[model samples]
Target chain A: MNRIRKNPIFIIVSFFLLINVFFIITAGDSFFQLDNYFYVLKQTAMIIIVASAARFL
Target chain B: MTGNYDLSTGSVVSFAGCVYALMIKSGMALLPAGIVAVVVGILIGVINGTMVAKFNFPPFIATLCMMYISRGVALILANGATIRDNMPPEIGNLASRDFLGLPIFVVFIIIALLIFVFIEKKTLLGKYALAIGGNKNAAFFSGINTAAIIFAIYVIIGGLAGFAGVMSASRLSAGDPRGMVGFEFDVILAIILGGTSLSGGKGSVIGTFFGALVVACLGNGLDMLNILTFWQSILKGIIFVLAIVLNEKVMKNISKKTVAAARA
Candidate 1:
């Protein structure tokens, strides 16, 4: 609980990120499927690159 | 279902074309339609900037109002239709043809992006924009025309929104005011996800582009995964909240480290 308070934001972001990843990974064909591979990559790349670059701005 | 994303083969043109398909199916023109969309978007952006900076209206309120105005105008122009019928011949060609394996729509986006980058990086107005965002009081004290700058920014914002509207019309082959309802939220969400601060001191065009991409990607992923439409909204909202919360934490951490270093 104290740990959560020390870095609530971090925990929150990490939580969502983990959820996203879990859903992406565990859903398999029923969940992930193979048809939209490029779509997923394009999106993940865009988010990571854009979100990380806020440091420069 | 897991770990199946392919990075080597993504095409912006194809993406644009796919969107175009939806518009065309609804009976809208394609070329002039797209051009008009871009112009309107820029107008909306400009209006947003002007209202906030010049009139001294709250930025959030001003933008929110403008969003409704823009959409309402589109709906009125389209006469309550989601797509236009019997568009010009040029419109169909632009939507259908590919240049060197790329859709014309993709080229259009690239050009728009290039112009945006040039304006943001290589111009004095850009410098002033950043300065004002960083410290309005300091910028005004340093002889910058903060009011004029803000007005200009709002116009640009309004204009961009208009452009999006036009694009929506073109893709749908008809001017549908209701096309992509709640899209403003998506735009803001992308911006925040890209790391722009709501407090108005930090933002990046590059970040925005990436943020937009992220949103586009997420939507695509959901579709591929067969996620329900209602769940998409929920997911996006969750992301928005998480981004702000994360940003606050990151800022706090940085400040703490700075203070510790000063003490040392």
Candidate 2:
């Protein structure tokens, strides 16, 4: 069970790194911009609030 | 049987909610309007069940067809315009009303969870849904009413979807045909996170609640960490595959232990 869980976590981290690398290599300056970071967070806020409300559900 | 049930929900929400808004728009009373929308949802489910159970169409195809049909009907019913006017305030109140400082919709979900938990644990309907899902052919041989059970399952799911539709429309104060485009995926992810097997036959209502939390957290975390939506989808798929693998292994171990204990 631990191995099964671990393998996926590793894959997720690796995928995350791979995407970040790709974006940096292609658009280095824009990829690391603070505004972009905030923009993504802004879009994710609603999903978070709606999804987290399931705890109450 | 339920592996594709999510497909029906996507359109059912849109379709039923559309009917609800339209009914009120046409000057129908709140009670009757809500009833009409719910009936439409159940009828769609019955049609889906008939297609899969009696006519021998594959569940995926039949429900996929229903999804498109229902969505089309919704879009047409509103004449491609969003319905925001002429709705009775009482109808909207069902979704937005507060109970003890909590949103009514959240309360509804809790109640739904409680009722589902009871049905899953204490009712024959729950047992049969599992039995049929586990093995339809064997369930048939054992004298179970597989067809009827399957029909009931779809109809129940449809009714729930209808309720969701109405709540959504009420909250927004209008029904938009284009709403909830990919919500089915989020719901499926929640169910799977809840430890329900994608292959069917095993599920826990409580687990689903937790699974929903997990998805929400992951989505939130990803966004906070600056991950792109494109990458988020891929990562989500990976997590689902990994979770299923983990769940299968755990189930196998538990079953093996039970078998050994029986022999002892």
Candidate 3:
């Protein structure tokens, strides 16, 4: 378990799981709608994708 | 970055979009309008670089001034009105339409990042940026042209911001001077989350990339739950603070080692 936690993949998956759980509880059935997920992804596509360009020397 | 350099980046994006839209509206060819707008952004970068590097103005102060200037210019150019929906088919098409069965912007992001990764790992400029970030004084003592490097950094950031400005405007099919406000905050947060040190002496393009994705995911997930904007801000604030705390703690030893080496 500790080893898995050290892996970024595990951490990211768990984080998403936690978020998924929280949303499922709060928004209920609406949370399961695939389109909602797609909408959120589309909304921040640029914000998320382009930020990696920082050359912070 | 001690400099409010990122602040001006947001403005550059707005200004570039406005310039592009205005030129296109005035019947310029799409290619010329795009070129002119991006050149305008680069010119702002030159101003920022000169002020900070030559005049010895504090970077934050110089960039803060530039920020307001650019934003104001964008607003004035548009006369406080949004330029919406009348763009030539090519104007916003890069962001709005997909090509080859993939979103164009996504493909752009992939290619741009691949290029960045190559540069960061293989180029002299990238190494200089990392060295300078780690310790400006040390980098200078080691014969790196610190001012030139810093100037180049701002210019690169400026250019990226300019492209982003075009992308956002195109996606919305409008150039709103007020659009992209507070975008710097997101950039900074993304950087921090990627393990880039605020104290200087370290940089990670890959980390920044993943960090940005994580932040976007968090924000999107919250929106899914219909989280109020007020609560979202608070949550985001918490995450930002957490990332900072984690970064400071984890990098403390590394910074200490580098500082010791520099002193030696």
> Every model's DockQ, to 2 decimals?
0.11, 0.06, 0.33
**lDDT per residue as tens, model 3, B217-245:** 67766776677878988988898999888
| Poorly placed runs, candidate 3 (over 4 Å) | A1-50, B1-5, B85-90, B256-264
In candidate 2, position B47 carries an lDDT of 93
C-alpha lDDT of residue B119 in model 3: 75
* TM-score (0 to 1) for chain B of model 1: 0.75
How much of the real interface does each model capture, measured as fnat? 0.02, 0.00, 0.31
Could you give the CAPRI-style class of model 3? acceptable
The lDDT of each candidate is: 0.50, 0.66, 0.72
Tens digit per residue, CA lDDT, model 1, B1-264: 000111101111122223343444555555544554445445545555556656676655765575566555544544556443554444445344456755545544555567666766798677776676667789889999877766655444444443444333344444444545554455556556555555555555656665665566567657757899899889888988987786666556655766799999
- lDDT, candidate 2, A1-57, per-residue tens: 654443323333444456556565655566556655444333322222222222111
Residue-level lDDT of model 2, residues B147-192, one tens digit each, is 7777777776676677667777776789888787766666666665
Which 10-residue window of candidate 3 chain B scores lowest in summed lDDT?
A: B1-10
Judge the docking of candidate 2 as incorrect, acceptable, medium or high: incorrect
Q: What's the lDDT of the predicted structure labeled candidate 3?
A: 0.72
